[model samples]
Target: MGKAMFEKEKVCFSFRLIDMGNGSQVIDESIKTPMDALTPELQAEYMEVHEQLAFMKTIQKNNRRETERGRKLVRNPLHRLACFCGLA
Candidate 1:
């Protein structure tokens, strides 16, 4: 017989807070369980999505840093001098 089918009474949304500077992440949001869940496949898929999201966050952080570095390399001496002397 096929695994018993069950419907989730309520859908749950999850969120995470990440500190891109240090590559640290925390799941600050709560997770709700599903109803009449069949095999463990669903759970596995959910975890996979979160993993992908975390990876993307890390990549985004790195990209931002690289872009900033590139901009600094193109800085004008006049601008740098202004900041150094507290005048623009």
Candidate 2:
């Protein structure tokens, strides 16, 4: 990963791997982005953008759940109708 960073992003990042058990491992990574060196105003702006992205993700998740629930609702009647007609 460090080598890839040097080749692609041209930035130095460090990480370590910890073995859990049974061939499982976890990566503890630390990367310095340009945002880390931002000024106060820029940091605030970055945080605002981050918050907006989190909000959007949450909204998308709720929307997906609602859509799946709606699909189930729509299918339930058809399923019942099929069962009534001995087609199920």
Candidate 3:
């Protein structure tokens, strides 16, 4: 009976926000819950919240990567001037 129920719902992904020394850390993890242990309605709510939180973290990660890339591509005026003088 227990095995049958788990096979139906499958495993879910969960995200947790942790506070570190400087900033917050987002952790993505696989969570296994026995759906039969909770009311069906509550199980549905939990899974919904889990997926939304994971999606939020993914968005944050992509934005941070884009910001870093933009910084690297910036032109340094001093370097450009030196190169123009053939000092480089």
| Strongest candidate by TM-score | 2
| Selected candidate, larger TM-score, 2 vs 3 | 2
RMSD per candidate (Å) reads 12.5, 15.4, 8.6
Please report the TM-score between candidate 2 and the true structure: 0.47
lDDT of 1 by residue, 1-88 (tens): 4344564345443643434667865555564444234246756655676688789999999999999986885497877888789886
Q: Between candidates 1 and 3, name the one with more favorable TM-score.
A: 3
Q: Look at candidate 2 and give me any clashing residue pairs.
A: none
For model 2, how does the per-residue alpha-carbon lDDT over 1-88 read when each residue is reduced to its tens digit?
Answer: 5666667443322333356988975545563335445677856755665566579889999999999998896689888798789987
lDDT of 3: 0.64
**Segments of candidate 3 deviating more than 4 angstroms:** 1-36, 75-88
Q: Summarize candidate 3's per-residue lDDT along 1-88 as a digit string, tens digits.
A: 6778667554443433344887855444553445555577867766776788779889999999999876654466766687789976
Clashes of 3: 0
**Root mean square deviation (Cα) for candidate 2:** 15.4
Candidate lDDT values, in order: 0.64, 0.64, 0.64
Q: Decide which is better by lDDT, 1 or 3.
A: 3
